[model samples]
Target chain A: MPALRKGRCLSPILLALMLVAGLIALPPGGRLTANEPQARLHNVDIREFAFMPAELTIRLGDAIVWTNRDFAPHTATSAEGDWDTSEIAYGQSSRQTPTQLGVFDYICVFHPTMKARLIVTR
Target chain B: MTPIKTTLLAGFAVFALTLPAFAQAGLDDLEVAHAAYTADVIDIEYAKLALSKTKNPEIKKFAELMIRDHTAVNEGAAALLKKLGVQAKDNDFSKALLKGFEAKKKELSALDGAAFDRAYAANELAYHQTVNKIVGETWIPTVKNGELKAFLSQALVTFKAHENHAGHMVTAAK
Candidate 1:
């Protein structure tokens, strides 16, 4: 059926629609809509000496964590001093409360070559 | 050893010693990547929400790309975590995002058609511009890897494209 095909092919389309609908339906100060898992995330791989995820999205109240897999140290610093990791050491971590909702831009302070986005939904 | 060879040998030894600190700094993001990635997933959700409901066709397409590409990119990030031997737990930031999005959902929904498009476009412009500055100003110079340097060099491409798109929409709206 074309409906099924559309569903399959345009799954991303439907997802886009739902994403917007979800935002439009978001409550003030960001209240979780569904009782879905709290840590719904997209991991960013730092390999080939690059920030793999490049950009990512998370709900308000969610967190964005970074890891250093390569042979060099990297940092996840937010632009405009919004939020940042103070040089997450190799095999170490940093965490933050993205309570404020907005598209936050960040980069690894050490590498300057590693960049990522933390999109906090609200 | 030849004079040039001696110089090269010394450089290699010093380079090896200095490289560890560079790697150590990069690894720090790993500590935050998992949690950060989840929060960012929420951002994509918002961008898509704005796109689908917008009256503007271009905004719609761009939103679609944001959703699809970002999803793939995020997934890749997950695999990267596995490769690097990292495990992530759901943290407070993710909880806050869910709560915030649920709160803002209705207002964003109310802005329909052109109004929705304008808001969405403006938001995109802001987001991409910030991304560009961070990548150019921060990420590009963060690492010691030559390959990464070149790869990061291209990050501005998408941000610039979004800027142009959003700029057009904003200009059209005025």
Candidate 2:
């Protein structure tokens, strides 16, 4: 009975080990597993009439959230008219996910001097 | 500071020193709020006049931004005052700002076409420079209320941005 109990205890341990090993052994660039890095959310800040990073890079599926730390309202509007996070007021935030993979230049419509760029990669 | 900023500061200091209204020791919290709110209203008025008179796209865009931003700032000031359960008291500084606005209105009303746009751009630049100087150098230091001080600090950043934008517009309009 002691040996039987030992076997039962080792079963889950071995299974967990196998699962981890399987995840590790999965082919690169094949398919995303439970342990693979997934889409991420990045943050940008607007303060003193400028974007904190002024430029960013992310994966295709990643998202960016812009928070206004200035008293004035602002927007992240794409130069090509592709996307716009419009009228983000003080203490407010807006989010965007780029569907296309490339470089995009954007500016605050209210204050055109405020400029930034985003790089999206697959 | 940049040369332009230094010039703006020196010019604003002279303008402020000339105004007997702001030379007082300091303004109370309500008085500060009143002056800030009045400034917002005056900018909105100027923007409206710009919209009515100018056909230039750049000037029109700048005017629209002034109206939207100043209106928003005034609304925020009004909400904060309501929350504190007090009304902003009209002081000499506020009165002086209104008087100055009336004088500028008459001056701007006399111009037309590109001349009007150029004058409007220059006025916006000077107005922002003066307001930013006062808000940064005066009210932020003297206001006793923590919330009001914080509000002014944030508003100063926006006004400073406006000063820079106006500088660019002044060049473009010319």
Expressed as tens digits, the lDDT of each residue in B1-174 for candidate 1 is 445334433543353343333333443343335434554475588677976686666676666656653554455556555765666545443454355445445545767777666655655554455445544655566644453444345334434544665667667754
> Which number leads on TM-score?
2
The global C-alpha lDDT for each of the candidates, from Candidate 1 onward, is: 0.54, 0.81
Q: Residue by residue across B44-131, what tens digits does model 2's lDDT show? A: 9999999999999999998999988887777778889999999999988898888778877877898899878877898899888778
Per-prediction DockQ scores?
0.02, 0.44
Model 2 agreement with the true structure over A65-99: per-residue lDDT tens digits:
99988767899999998899989987899999888
TM-score of chain B of each: 0.58, 0.89
Calculate each model's fnat, 2 decimals. Answer: 0.00, 0.58
Q: What value does DockQ give for candidate 1?
A: 0.02
Those runs of model 2 whose alpha carbons end farther than 4 Å from true positions after fitting are A1-33, B1-17, B20-25
Q: On residues A32-117, what C-alpha lDDT tens digit does candidate 1 reach at each position? A: 34423344445566654467777777776555556665433457788777667676544555656666778877776544445667
Which window of ten consecutive residues has the lowest lDDT sum in model 2 chain B?
B4-13
Query: In model 1, which runs have C-alpha deviations exceeding 4 angstroms?
Result: A1-122, B1-27, B35-40, B88-106, B139-157
Collision count of model 1 = 93
